[model samples]
Target: MLKLLFPILVMLGFAQLTPVSDFFTWDRNLILQGEVWRLITGNFTHTNLAHLIMNAAALMVFCFIFKDILNPKKLWGLLLSISLMTGGLLLLSPIQSYVGLSGVLHGLFIWAAIEDIKQQRSTGWLLLVGVVAKIAWEQYFGASASTISLINANVAIEAHLIGACCGAILQLLYYFYTLSTASDAPK
Candidate 1:
């Protein structure tokens, strides 16, 4: 696990560099101009140290909690899939730019929670409800004042919604795919 996490944390550290973040952040116009990699890179960048720490901590927690199921390949695949989906969906919103991992973290949490439920763990229900409620609160009211102050930017609540939805959709697709594959196996 340390092997898998070391490289990611290192990459996150590098992303904090001003020039790197400026280059990687999801800029609507830049993407339209053919800088498509921003879709993945932006999610790894951050507005500030506080934002990075908050997201890094969450990532660690989710990785720890879902260690049983999260191998490097699975983790990377989930991160990439959610990042791409969320970034693509963000194009439809009014947001011109974004940088942070919170959206991908939400998606990771949702995906792990769904996995927990598949394994018949009751905690999955709790996590799912908790995240949904949090998203709902953010959407209806707005991001917490403290978070906005800490991150030094207005939170993009739409990204949270899109990321969580992407997680659920991807997990469901995986579940069905496995089901069909199992059924096709010789008895």
Candidate 2:
């Protein structure tokens, strides 16, 4: 709904304003030094306008595909969920810094694809396979060499993996919930 999307558009715009992104980008040592806000804000910031537009467009597509499910509050929760997973991956690794919403976009796509699966849509399986293939490609080839040209930065592929894993966990939780509720319903 416009109610949810309007705010996201606004937030994304806010992220692009000068001076704000510098304070928000994820920096490993900075985090270790206790600048904790980066954990959440980094995902909202971007390396450049192209990078922001790419990620924002992907986010819009995700929202449209899963609009039936991702209302404003739930969208915020999903962002938070994937942000933690991506942040944890960055924290545990030797990698010093990173930024972008692509990581969270992966999780959102995976989550939406799983929802498609629950509805028996073939697109679900296709999306799941495509996502896995993309991750595998990135892991093997390394940080999507091509993105360096587009975004002027290397990709943190691990973030994509972590987000996918988190999305799958969300789907698993829903699976168990459905099974439990179905069994509990009186005949």
Candidate 3:
């Protein structure tokens, strides 16, 4: 597990070296100018220490939970899904400048929930409920000023939704593949 996550952690560490504003380097002007790489790169960039910490913490927790169940193969699939969905969301977003791992976190949460469901785990629905409620609160009420205060903040709620959808779709595909393969095997 560490082998897979180590490189991401290292890349995130290096990303911290660059100024926060650099993340917005591929903002409206650059996109208009045809620098498309930003759509993908921006997902790796973060604006501040707090942002990095929050994202890193979430990544650690989720990786710990899903890594064992997904194994190396599914881990790679999850990572690929996160990257592709994040980039797709960024490209579709009206907002030109943004940075955070909220999208990936959403993806992980959805993936985990779906996995639990496939395993016939009762906690899966609970987890799904919790995630949905939290997302709803964040989207409708905004981050509570009293509980979690954010400064100079702009939340890309759309990215979170899109990433979750991507994760759910991937999980569905994985579930179908597993079911078909199991059935096809000789008894």
Q: Highest lDDT among the candidates is held by which one?
A: 1
- Candidate numbers, best lDDT first, in rank order: 1, 2, 3
Write the residue-wise lDDT of candidate 3 on 1-187 in tens digits.
7876777777666766766347533364576677666555566667667777778778888888766685656665676567566765666768767666677778888889988987898878888888878778777877656324442466677677777777787788877899999999999
- For each of the candidates, give the backbone clash count: 0, 0, 0
Q: Is candidate 1 or candidate 3 better by TM-score?
A: 1
Summarize candidate 2's per-residue lDDT along 25-110 as a digit string, tens digits.
88888888999888877888888899999998888878877788778888998888778777766787666888888888888888
- lDDT by candidate, in order shown: 0.92, 0.83, 0.71
Which of candidates 1 and 2 reaches a greater TM-score? 1
Measured against the true structure, the TM-scores of the candidates, in listed sequence, are 0.96, 0.88, 0.79
lDDT of 1 by residue, 74-169 (tens): 888999999999999899999999998888889999988888898999999999999999999999999999999999999989999889998998
**RMSD in Å for candidate 3, one decimal?**
3.3
Prediction 2 global C-alpha lDDT? 0.83
Weakest ten-residue segment in model 1 by summed lDDT: 1-10
